[model samples]
Target: MSLNSLASTIEGAQLVLRCKNLNDSINFLTTRLGFKVRMIMPSEAPTIAVLSAHGCTVRLEMVPNATPDAAHLRLLCKPALLPAGTPPRLSGPDGMVVDLVDAHAPVHVPPAVQEFVLTRLAGPESWGVGRAGMLYRDLIPSRLNGRFVASHILLPQGGPVPDYVHYHRVRFQVIFCKAGWVRLVYEDQGDPFVLQAGDCVLQPPEIRHRVLESSGGAEVVEIGCPAIHETHGDPGMHLPTGAWLPERSYDSQKFVRHVAAATPWGPSRLPGFEARDTGISAATEGLGGVRVLRPATGPANAAVESEALGAPGAHQGEFLFLFVLAGQCELGSTVLGQHALHAGDSCVLPAGADYRVSPAPGLELLEVTLPARLPA
Candidate 1:
């Protein structure tokens, strides 16, 4: 797969820790708190440990050795790190090397506080390999034509992530809770929405909100129209102002109390979303606490004639995810080399990927499009 062509871009001013012995260091970090492994790259040789993590979706990656390929792995790993031997002051690609060095100089956050933070954040559904903090994960952003910004996020159970929201810009937020649940407090609306496991919530931009609290934390995969950072406004936005739903919410409290609580909301179950057109090989569909969409039929052959020079009529500039939930697909591409993608596999189409799918029944996918940046 093409690394640069992959969807998603990194965010700004986030934490990214890099080290030589990634596996062991990650193990230590996760054990301490506020970090969990989400995705891990496939490795056969015992010496190689190429992995990434979401420091709240700020990408962090590592390579076990300083081999040539590991260099590519290292560069690719740090969308943030700077060139080597360039004076520690000039470390990150961004102008923050000096700042990072200054921060690292003082390990001010006490170990107790770090552990406390870890207890509050939630875990993701697909915790790829590794234990806790050192788990493998990737942050694949969906940036179409270098304009629209779509980011994937993973929030680990942790300490206090104070309740707050951003006011600098507007955005349309679609959040999917794959595993665990969180309590959402909308300052404007007043009442907190107890989004349970498998539930989805759509919040309009500039809506003041934050996670009042969480139980077992929660794994939230959020896709938004236009991504703008969410920050707390002035002190005016605080608790007691937003209604906190303590009882209706189903969390560890429910099981602890022995109440028969059920999910209160879920994703849209559009009919055409799961159905394959024709000559398709396989398909899968699910709604409720989790959503999965996959192709039922195999890949379709390109007519290879008159339409070769132009874009498809109906869908233009739209991105698609060919997700393999069960089997594999023989992915052919002019740029990316040929490979077989198995279940839990995903590929992104920028302007779009032109490839024929092999007849496999269990490849599921979800197609998401951001609202036009400027009005259509």
Candidate 2:
């Protein structure tokens, strides 16, 4: 048959192997081979089992006289797509040989462009209708080559929103309440809670959540990785109905909520600024960090010492941004020549560029960086 004809007739291909012991083979495939058990035949003393990994499926049939030479399996995938530490070859319980080959496709990466971003007060023209008919403004239009997306969302009409329970498949994301207040609920987080100005939440990947209501004019700043991600609706599940699981993890990430009022300012790397950690670092497993920063009181011109402000250094990650929340400041970096930042003004600093900020008294800013852990 022609290749096209054969492809048309096949839904999927599964390798069939004979195993001396079914249970041992199943255990080896799942525990060592990293395959998920899809099905097992016969409730007790099963002779057949199915397993899958990386979209490839296989069936193991138990037989008294099984041999490794019975079948040969070869799988191909991009080297970058394989899980870290995965070996190139693996032997199953019945001496089955599996060869893993690299397809060597170029990784999908955002384009490289000189970083430059400036957003003014979002006017009617800047606002666009988004999910649930809400208004949104692109805060970082370039989004660091599509590695991240920062948006300003506003609920114009507000109250009893018809938002559905949904979750995103993002590497990292955080929402900060910028104005007014919003009510929201999350899976396993008991009851709906209101998020006021300055409050922020780290919504871990795949954690179902819903926006219940908001006061008119309520605004929020949201940042997420990859700029684009899937938002899947969970019609079968509802939020705020289960016991709170503060320590529970979803996809290796934990949810975090930081109330500005309850969080205390701590010493910052910069002498003149105090910072409030938004608990995003812990939730993202070193993928990101969020900090609310403001000039420490008692210093009118508390300039960060030039000697202390190390030479411009570039980050090794995808994104770094600073948003002025209040007052004014002068920021200098290798990527952004010394520039003044006012309330609502922001800048994206390219990775590997050393930067420094000089704040006027009472200046407040929001800073975010990917890969929470920075190299010294």
Candidate 3:
């Protein structure tokens, strides 16, 4: 009944174009557009040519009188590929216009339009299908004006993930597991490892990895700089390259896997809570850091038993993200009124925005900040 309902049954897309001169059109598509011919009409003189390139297939039909749209093809590539003194727009012999543009461009982080944001799961609509059939719930819907993105991703029907070896072009990115477990493999990481609840991994830029499998209902929180970026596939590259290089650099950054089970609770800057450092600070050279904070209670918090834990430290940096992992807490600020957050809730406070967080006996949250250590 709706277009969304038809989405599952759809297979692929093919572009059909009528051309007055099929020979010239084929040559233009092949040479100018970088498309390769896949099929032809007859052995002697072909009237049609089926071409495929860049994940798209097109069929150029031979028609004596055909008035096609002005935009027959918009090729995204380096402008230098065109002849000297030629403009970006070109008219081929078939009367079709081709627009040339840049495809492999550098990452762009738009100017920050910062604002205080609070998000919670609304209903089933809050979840959308993403790559590898994972369900993604947008944590930062505003995307901080395209400067950053935080997503709550999950796999309801977890098993062998259909994901391939891939890498992203980003300035900063990390994944924190919130529930269940996921087995993943990374380049030169020795072997596949499982990431359990309350754990995290720092995915340096251009680090090739693959999602081998996951437990049912597995979920994670993903944060990255620059809301828009590219995910390039590395199908030919194999993981666990048999070399174990813990100090290897992936674009000036090292991969980190922080296991929660082995981490001990220690004094945190925020009062009334102890924190378990994820070691991301030292690994990233203070570019970013993560801490799992929980209110001090029982014998498990001996490390912070003697330390003075105060009210939530005023976040003093470029960014601050807080996600309620368990129990409940109230976030209040002089600018914004008080709001209670429960499990699965997330909030972001702008720079220099003084805020106070409510602490309960069972309260626990994950805090991520840029510049790992804030200035005093």
Q: Largest lDDT belongs to which candidate?
A: 3
Q: What lDDT tens digits, residue by residue, belong to model 1 across residues 62-167?
A: 5455332211111222323433333332243433342223211211211110000001112464344322222333223323222223323334555444334432
Model 1, residue 179: displacement in angstroms?
Answer: 1.7
- Model 2 compared with the native: what TM-score? 0.68
TM-score of each: 0.40, 0.68, 0.74
* Candidate 2 lDDT over residue span 1-376, tens digit each: 2435322423344577888988788779878989865544332125666677887888787889876664545555554545557667656666676666553322233664547576766459888766655777888776667677787788998688867777776778899888899999999988889999999999998798999999999988888776755555566686777779989898788889889999999876556677899888888788788998887777534655222224434555556677887788887766567788887777776655666778887688887877775543
Give the top-scoring candidate (TM-score).
3
User: What lDDT score goes with residue 348 in model 3?
Assistant: 86
- Per-candidate Cα lDDT values, in order, are 0.35, 0.73, 0.77
Considering summed lDDT, which 10 consecutive residues are worst modelled in model 3? 302-311
lDDT of 3 at 207: 89
What residue pairs are clashing in model 2? 287-371, 312-354, 313-352, 313-353, 313-354, 314-352, 314-353, 315-351, 315-352
Candidate 3 C-alpha lDDT tens digits along 239-341: 9788788999887789999999999999777656779999988888899889999977754532222121242335556677889888887787767778889
Q: Could you tell me which residue pairs clash in candidate 3? A: 271-309, 271-310
Candidate 1 matches the true fold with a TM-score of 0.40
